[model samples]
Target: MANIRPYKISISESQIQDLKTRLSLSKFPDELDNAGWDMGAPLADIKRLTRHWESSYSWKTAEAELNSLPHFITDIQCDGFQPLAIHFVHIRSKVQNAIPLLWIHGWPGHFWEGVKIMKPLTEGDGVEHPAFDLVVPSLPNFAFSEGTKERGFALAQYAETLNKLMLKLGYNEYVTQGGDWGTHISRALAHLYPQTCKATHLSMDAANPPSFLANPVLTLQHMLTPYSKREREGQSRTEWFTKEGRGYNLEQSTKPQTLGYALVDSPVACLSWIYEKLHDWTDNYPWTDDEVCTWVSIYWFSVAGPAASTRIYYETHHTTRTPENPRAVPRDMLRAYSPGVKLGYSHFPMDLVVLPSTWVRTLGNVVFERDHEDGGHFAAWERPGELVKDLRDMFGKKGGAFGCVKGANGYSQ
Candidate 1:
């Protein structure tokens, strides 16, 4: 059994002072006369955020709030990789039979992403909705978790780490919820361990248009079914992301090390890089300066450093590609059918990749799906209420995935 020890976040005073010092020394870049978001994070917004981050934002307060959660660390050794100290928040519901849920976060996101939905999902009247015992982890190379020095730590390695963590916690079977990199990782988990990973829920799933050769039934359904107004609008959003917003993906996937220098050396550069995504990705979600700073602070002071997070993009894309290897980049396989593990999707219109209903249905045994008109990529943060409701509905008594996990129906006795 892996030794699980309690953990607490404690960023040194020197690190705090150094961040402020770097912010003070940051050089401002000039922007076009009217180049709003289209040109990138506006100079004015970055300047304002920089000033707030340096002058008024409080890391101590945020750290305190983060530390209040049930933090723990354990050494999880993935195959062929050194043991990494994995930081996670494990909150067991009072309901004895609550479903064990592993909520994952992707790049530019950490374990803290589950903050909003943490409490609500874990506490519910047995009769109305089911409760969940939530385990939100800082993936290796993100947040307080340690990074891997060796290469080839792709999707399979990530899935392996999380699976081991769940097993160590005595959760032999579990379900997953995630978006962004979370969606990909969860899909990988389902594909790799269909028996243990019983069900999965995703907010940002990616899938190609159904082809007659692969999914003739779904392809026929896709051909006959006219795209809904919302699906059409979602395609437009996806196009905008593919054309205008995918430069970061290309850079990070191919040349993360080059970009790492900027992220690690300059706090301002790191802020600007992530701030653009936060601004562009969400659906007009109001962001306070403190909130923005706290989010970026987690990255700025992450155990593996801000640059380490970008390597996931590179590794997932560049890792060994083989038909037999389950760990290989899950490009076509994740979209392909995987039996046993039930699936659910919570579609948000403004997310980076928005696919039509019939298109995503080919992923697997999709039992539940919900479409929302008013959210973006960060569904857990932007629309926590809706996301939580979807989980409850999916696992509730009337839902398709109810009682999927053996002896853990998410309902009270």
Candidate 2:
């Protein structure tokens, strides 16, 4: 058994100096007249951010703040993969039998995204609401966690690593919340370990329209019901993503190695690459320069380097299964329903993949669903209170998934 040890964020002084040196030497490109977001991250915004990142931002202070969180590291050995050191934040609630919940993050996002909700989740109002013993892992390559060297370490491997980590922590049963790649990973866990992962709550909705062959009742319902105003608008948003915003997806999925060079070498290139999504993906969240730099800094100082994170796209895209011998839990199967685990969804208006209620219903035995008036891709960061509230309600006394994990009702006697 791998031992769990407390961890801290402590970047070297020389490394910080080196980062400044790189930022100081950044060279930006010329922009067309009035070329706002229609083109990409604007030059003016990038320039201002770069200037601040070089001169004003203090990574030392940022590092200290991150260090204050309850962080830990443990080795998790997947079946075929070598044991790798995994970093995570684990906060337990005082409420007796508080539910154990795993919060997973995706590409361009690290475990810090859970910082805002950590307190609220673990310290719910004792009388009425539910509390959680939160476990937020920095997915293998994305942050402090070590990355794998072998290829084909796709979603299944990611899911297995996390499941083992949870079990290692003595959380025999738990619930989950995720967005972006996290949504897929959490679903994979639910599919592979239905007994262990009792329920899931997702901010990003990724599911197909119910099929006549598989879900005739749902297909009929989907066909008969008129699209809500929100659903119609959601289609337009999704279309915009497909037509205008998926260039990164193509690059990351097809040739991450080629793009990795630019990302690894140039701080400005990495900044602009992530900054564009931070700007376009959110619903006009007023981001401070420090906020932008802090986010990018994680990628810049990531354990496996930024390039390693993008390989998941290629691996997932290239996953293939033969008819004679099917994969135990196929990637596409995560999109369909898993019978045992209860599911919940929270739909943010400006999220990348905004689907209708009927379509999302096909993902699982959905017991709770909520559509917010405003929010975007990074829901926990942009709207922490709302997201935490949804989790509390989902597992509270009257919730559909209440007591889903034995002895963890998250309430005071």
Candidate 3:
């Protein structure tokens, strides 16, 4: 493995200027009082967030912080012709003999979830995770990493990219964690290279596929009761979300270009699109306005929103889709106490779900499941401290545990 090279973030002044120019030029349509998000970004909220993004948010601070953490870009050759260059932050354990941990993030979010975890992993002194080293990367076309230049950039290919990344790092064995697309891709990694990925932790999952025609794995309580308390409040909200959220999902998968205008044109639109997801997933528990800005800032200054979400959709949509090998690996679920999507659901709670190859064969051992008292889909950001603790504890105790982390109590055992 090459000695880790020092890398700097590449956000240009011109790009920032272009973004501001675009935001300044935004021609918002006139909206009557109480006219809501039915059209898209709410005028009231978008105006407020745009004002802050243009005036107060500092890209340099975030960029420097990202730079302070170890970062690198390396290529992996596969179905994708050009050696795929992946962007990652490798946080070495302050103490020697740290375990190596690979973290993959979902769409609409980057490595930022795992990027800032090293400090907590090392317990303020970087002395912890002595048994672990952290690797967090932005998926192709998402962040700094360029998307595949070739014709075959599928989710499975992305898993292979991860495999090469691990081998390149000289790690024959390591653990993994993810949610959303990360959940499926990590599963693909384990299935593609189980020897290299010893065990994986996921933040989204359920028991394996239906065991019988009549009796499924789902519990009566689960089927009868709402997925979460907040969901039971109203069926109308659930219906509205289904109708609306599906449009975004379908467009992203089928016709990403259709929605690109608003997202690609206005920084305000871009921020709203992503921020709303984060806000909803975390149950919108009154986050600090700046708390919302950090995520938007990453997408804004980097100028990587519309395309980032689309590429993931593109790759996932076009991947090795077939009946012979429907899914690649097992997914563990870490259910957040109150997530918005859970509020809007019928049978399936998530949007894009892929079952594994061993899905029907090994139901019991495959899916690791757990529920948390706090946090939702964006666990890493909303509840980093808790996320870290759970990750350590889960992995540490797994006589066959999937994901593990411990906070003040210590996951080191």
> Which 10 residues in a row give candidate 2 its minimum summed lDDT?
321-330
Among the numbered candidates, top TM-score falls to 1
**lDDT assessment of candidate 2:** 0.89
Q: Which of the two, 2 or 3, has more lDDT?
A: 2
TM-scores of all predicted structures:
0.98, 0.97, 0.77
Instruction: Give residue 46's lDDT in candidate 3 (0 to 100).
Output: 73
Residue-wise C-alpha lDDT for candidate 1, range 23-133, written one tens digit per residue: 999998777787989989999999999999999998999999999999999999997889999999999999887899999999888888789999998887666989889
Selected candidate, larger TM-score, 1 vs 3: 1
> Which model scores highest in lDDT?
1
Tens digits of per-residue lDDT for model 2 on 1-413? 45999998888889888889999999989999989897999999999998999999999999989999999999998877798999999999998788899999987788987789999989976568898999999998888999999987888889999999999999999999999988999898988889899999999988888899988998999999998767888998999999999999999999999999999999999999999999899998999888899999999998898898899888888776667424434667778788899999999989998998988888889989988889999999999999998998888887888888998875634
Instruction: Residues 32-72, candidate 3: write the lDDT tens digits.
Output: 88876566667788778777767776666767776777788
- Candidate 2, residue 76: Cα displacement in angstroms equals 0.6
Candidate 2 C-alpha error for residue 362, in Å: 1.0
As for candidate 2, its clashing pairs are none
Q: Clash totals for all models, in order? A: 0, 0, 21
Which parts of model 3 are misplaced by more than 4 Å?
36-40, 124-131, 206-209, 213-244, 301-305, 320-368, 397-399, 402-413
* Candidate 1 RMSD to the real structure: 1.4
TM-score of 2: 0.97
